[model samples]
Target chain A: MLTTAPTAVGDDAALALWVLHELHYRGFAGVDDGLEWEPTLLQVRGLLEADLERRLRGRWTPPQGLSFVDDALEWIDGQDGVSLARHVHRDADRDQVLDLLRVRSLYHLKESDPVSWLVPRLGVPAKAALMELQFDEYGNGDPNRLHHHLFATGMAAAGLEPSYDAHVDVVPLEVLEQNNTLSLFGLHRRLRGAALGHLAAFEATSSLPSRRMAEGLKRLDLPPEIIAYYAEHVEADAVHEQLAVRTIAAALLDEEPDLEADLWFGAFTCLDLEDRFARRMLDRWGVGEVAA
Target chain B: MSEPGVAFEHPDVVLCPGGPMLLRGRHTVEDADGVPHETTRPVTAVCRCERSASFPWCDGTHKVLPPKLRPA
Candidate 1:
């Protein structure tokens, strides 16, 4: 049955859904591996996914054409709100940086694997562009330099565990949901447009925060290697931002004209969720509480 | 109960309280009854499979287990 609404954040419903989704990626240590394809679990997952999609579509208007990329780029460029990276760069302490790392690790540890699911479903230019971005994310075939590995290294430098799924329990639902959204889009072949849009939005907004994150690490007196991960994003995403928008999103529209709306919906939902996450962090930080 | 925060390279099969079988690979946790539970939850115990030093958890050692006996 389809869900009427999105699962509430941090509730058992969301966590249970997240666990079910996790089965598709990396099954938990002691859980039955066979449950990954259990019909009952898929039924529940479909409901949760539908709910999430309904909420996102309801809240965000998808753009009508390839031109939506231009509008999205403009909107992203015009956003002049308080910056999370700025806080990290200018005033964060060790604990604050660590907290940030912990929250981000929820996504970065797994890196681009979620989005990679869409690769087989995409056509030419878009697929190639995605591979271009993903190659760097995966460290261009160097196991030691993969973004996930770098993220893990950063986590380790901050005294957090580097193992995959190590911090699942501590990450806030918002963080989990952000990653879940991407996974949701990526896993569904029909949502290829949305997946690309999500990546575009992600890349568009990443550079500055990455720089700020690097600055935050430096301000906290962390080692250079710990800061390198963020610093690397500053450069990599700047390039990727262009590829994601023009090549991936635009090219996908060129191939499948009807998908423009889904693309925009994906991009906007990404931005919306990010804004919520950022605002939550800023509000917490404003009140002198740890945002993570 | 197992000590918290210890990393096991491999684990041994351990009987649960009710005689259920548990495979220890990469992460550790008690086998609840006889059913193996896969979770992202931190491993608090080791698996019992001799292949993994992590004990009470599958460190993915089962990946290379002889082609015939591999856990699907």
Candidate 2:
């Protein structure tokens, strides 16, 4: 039987969902893979996902009188959110940057894996577009070019543990919530629209910020590998941003016009989660104002 | 889809207003300085703003430029 939604996705609740979701990915050592479909655990996962969905939707205000596909890029640009990128660009110290890399690894290590779940859920136009974007994300047939591996190599060069889940225990609620949101959108077939929406927002924000991050790494005199990892994003995400917003997202909306609201919700969630994450980190670092 | 049962088809050219012109497939593009840059990725954005730091490839700098200053 499903327990009532936890008052909020507090630490225990978050961890419960995290463990349950991990079953779908790389299951724990000695854990039966069949547990992925266990009724009791799935019920709990369902409840948590419902709660997360409600929380996210409650915060979103879907754009009005506008074509979401045509206007999304400009809409995202107009929003003023606290920027962790700007902080890293100008003032963050070495430890601060390293801390960010560790926290970011929670998502970066599995980069693009969440959205990959949408592949089978889409029609030809959207599916083909998504694959085109994902093909690059997965390194265009070269393991050396794979984004997560690139991050891992960069992390090792920075003297941090590049192993999977090495920093999960230390990440804050904000970080966990961010990862949870990504997984939540991806895992549900019903939320495939939101998944691509998140991808569009993510790619849109990445290119310039990657440039800033690269510059910041240079400022800290960090190793060349670390800087190169970010430098790669500058050009890569520029291409991805266009493909995501124009091709992937546009094609999806074309096929399923009713998904417009869900798309906005997902896009809003992406920016909102990052805003919250940035605020938490900036406050922790005693830096500039966090976006409200 | 580029018609049913068509094994080979997709947009080879896409133009993003106020951004860059997306060129897909294997081709070489020459910068104004007469340097040829090969299109390595499936889709490459050739800078239209003429202000890109990496000539012949967009670095997303057009976003920072004013609407009037961006490509017309």
Candidate 3:
């Protein structure tokens, strides 16, 4: 069924594999739930996952040692390519904002659950720290304060549809593949370090763009509620970056020195995927087409 | 389309056909259908939905939904 190797994003094989992975989370409405555990499906998924992992490893090299987090943070800080946030904040029209939201909804809607799968695989300080960040993501037990809800609020405010998986058919496979990488890392217990590293990179880079996004929303005269999600990230991710780097990353390294390389790979891949996404958006925007 | 880039605001909350309550600034809820219902709450507020792992907020379920469909 895989039509091609995993050399390119949005390849049919990758998309099909991503679709198969969906059965475990929210199976398509009409699909049988029992398919979640079908042995044949598992066999196919395993092969595809292996191919995906092999390709990712070839492209990304994991960092080494407890210092890897710092290096990764520094690398992210040094990045100065096309700023998607700047465009949204300074120049984007309402439609552009809507397009950005739609693309992001592909990820922000589900937020942190994929990485949470690694919690049980972690020990002591790292587990506690990850849980702490996750607790905040979950809204600290308040059903009304969760981050995903905030994202949805922004989505609705942007006038885009906000249903879960509502846009899957339209999203480019690159976006889905970016997310699939996380699911692959999170689901495999051995890859817990990479999962944490990915979270670290994500938190490190989130704050500034979040602020830019909020500014963009405000400039468009969006209501305050819709802007709240981006604003929240401006502050929350600042704190999370530290916890992810020192607590999560450092603790993870202390526990399993061997995982340092994978941790770095996770961080590097985060940067690589985001860069690709940004390029795609900018390229489309330049061509007068909505990138999502 | 209503002229691209034209900003439009709906009522404070519009109940879509689906069950997920969409908050104007807080979160959007979806029902079995893909319709998005809009709601609004305080800044950084949460949503109230059973499927939310982060509760009142989304944890990127929309993205994860696709892969979750995969077996094992």
Q: Note the Cα lDDT for every prediction shown.
A: 0.68, 0.86, 0.68
Error of 1 at A266 (Å): 1.1
| Best model per TM-score | 2
Better of 1 and 2 by lDDT: 2
**First chain TM-score for all predictions:** 0.91, 0.96, 0.90
DockQ (Cα-based) per candidate? 0.01, 0.56, 0.02
Stretches > 4 Å off in candidate 2: A6-9, A290-292, B1-9
Positional deviation of residue A240's Cα in model 2 after best superposition, in angstroms: 1.2
For model 3, the local distance difference test gives 0.68
| Candidate achieving the largest DockQ | 2
Candidate 3 Cα outliers beyond 4 Å, as residue runs: A1-9, A62-66, A287-292, B1-72
* lDDT-superior candidate, 2 or 3: 2
lDDT for model 1 comes to 0.68
lDDT of 1 by residue, A236-286 (tens): 665566557755776677778888877777877788887677667766556
- Per-residue lDDT of candidate 3, residues A197-240 (tens digit): 78888887777677778888999998787799887776566556
Model 1 TM-score? 0.74
C-alpha RMSD for every candidate? 19.9, 1.9, 16.1
